[model samples]
Target: MADVVLQTINLTKEFTKRKGLSSPRHFFDKVTFTAVRDVDLTVERGEIFGLLGPNGAGKTTLTKMLCTLMLPSGGSATINGYDIVRQQNQVKRSIALISSEERSFYWRLTGRENLKFFAALYGLSGRAARSRIDEVLELIGMAAAADRRFQEYSTGMKQRMALARGLLADPEIFFMDEPTKGLDPVATRQLHDFIRDELVRQGKTVVLATHHLAEAEQVCDRIGIMSNGEMKACGCVSDLVGEASLIEYFHLLIEESRLEQ
Candidate 1:
């Protein structure tokens, strides 16, 4: 069996709905709404596992929980066999996050300067960090722009820089949320190729959360369809999309979700 990069058991999150000050107050006024309910899932090592859902479908929330950004209200999770809650540091050390809304860096600094700062934080400091910074800048094709100020870089260039920083830690797993969200067509395709290459060549696992069905279908080894705080179906690309187009499969799953509510 493949190693488990990430796993969740009966994972759940609840938000307490607070009543308005002007509204009638009662003991039952405050209610709990589960954002993720009793979710049990596993992601295998070296596999690109996609989580697909519409807006407000709990994809982001679930990712947050897996990355230890938010505490789970119930159940448990482990990253690379280390408990996410009990062994937060070990979990963090094993994974890297590449957010679509990449963090802004000092615009005055060079592209390579930003990556060096991140590399140092990952404890890859001094000569080694400097060398790795150069390596990643080249690996991501940012070497040509390495000495240029980040403010002068284009949107796609900045996105590539952010991704380079994510890889600086030499992480075993990557959590990428809508990685190609704002890129142009060419940039998006370049990024898609890079993601695939990482899995096929470098043997890293990924948790990819995106609304793009076709992209998910093309890249994922397995996919889980989530809606309304639950997983509707999960399997290989063809297994779930078999005998139907991806668009049709998505609609069918979504319609089933509505019927449940």
Candidate 2:
């Protein structure tokens, strides 16, 4: 039996846009834009599931809903068998979020210092926190640079630090949103290897949202292609790309989706 770790049923998110206050109609009228619509997704344990989409495709919205950062306007989801809506705390405990946002960290703080602070937020302290921080630093191959100020670190090192922070809690699942954004090709490849070689080795399930089709093909075990708030296609890489390059197939699906819209 396959162990399912994440599941979503008709997951949807909508944002309301109102006109300016100068217009009388603003008070009475609103436009509803659906960011994610009826997205049914399933991710199995210990597998890297990629959410591949272009901008405005709702990949980030879907991830946010699953992470409990944004409440779904409709439908439901569960992480590690815990309801994302009803059991918010439990859902949070079961997963970690990693993004390529360097501003989330204090510039002056050393990498180790930053991890320690985040560890405290995770309810770990003293020897337990220290041990975990050390473990993650080594795991991300940043033990030597742990004491360097975050601002001094290269983009790749910063990304590794972000991964280290995510691993602090040892969550069963990781939700990464454009984690390799702004990284060079070499750095991106290195990050991909770390995710596959080290993170998967620990039996962790990863949900990666990225615009890089090549990265998705290289890293993800299975991928779901999203377009205009809907899942356009999904399956194993080899199965989906049979007889055609992934780039060609990806463009075909995206073009077909545009025509339907």
lDDT for each candidate structure: 0.85, 0.91
Instruction: Give a tens-digit lDDT track for model 2, residues 1-261.
Output: 899999999998999877557567666678788999999989999999999987778999998899999999999899999999999999999999999898889989999999999999998999999999999998888999999999999988999999999999999999999999999998898889989998899999999999889899899999999888989888898887884577876787678667765
Instruction: Give the distance in Å from residue 95's predicted Cα in candidate 1 to where it truly belongs.
Output: 0.4
Total colliding residue pairs, candidate 2: 0
Candidate 2 to native Cα RMSD, angstroms = 2.1
> What TM-score do all the candidates reach, one by one?
0.91, 0.93
After TM-score superposition, what is the CA distance of residue 148 in candidate 2 from its true location, in Å? 1.8
lDDT by residue for model 1 (1-261), tens: 767878899988888876656466663477778888888999988889999977666888899888889899999999999998899889889988887874557788988888888787798989999888888888899999999999898889988998898889889998988888889999998888998985458989988998789889988888988888887778888877785576776777677666765
User: Deviation in angstroms for 204 in model 2?
Assistant: 0.6
Off by over 4 Å in 2: 21-27, 243-246, 252-261
Candidate 1's TM-score: 0.91
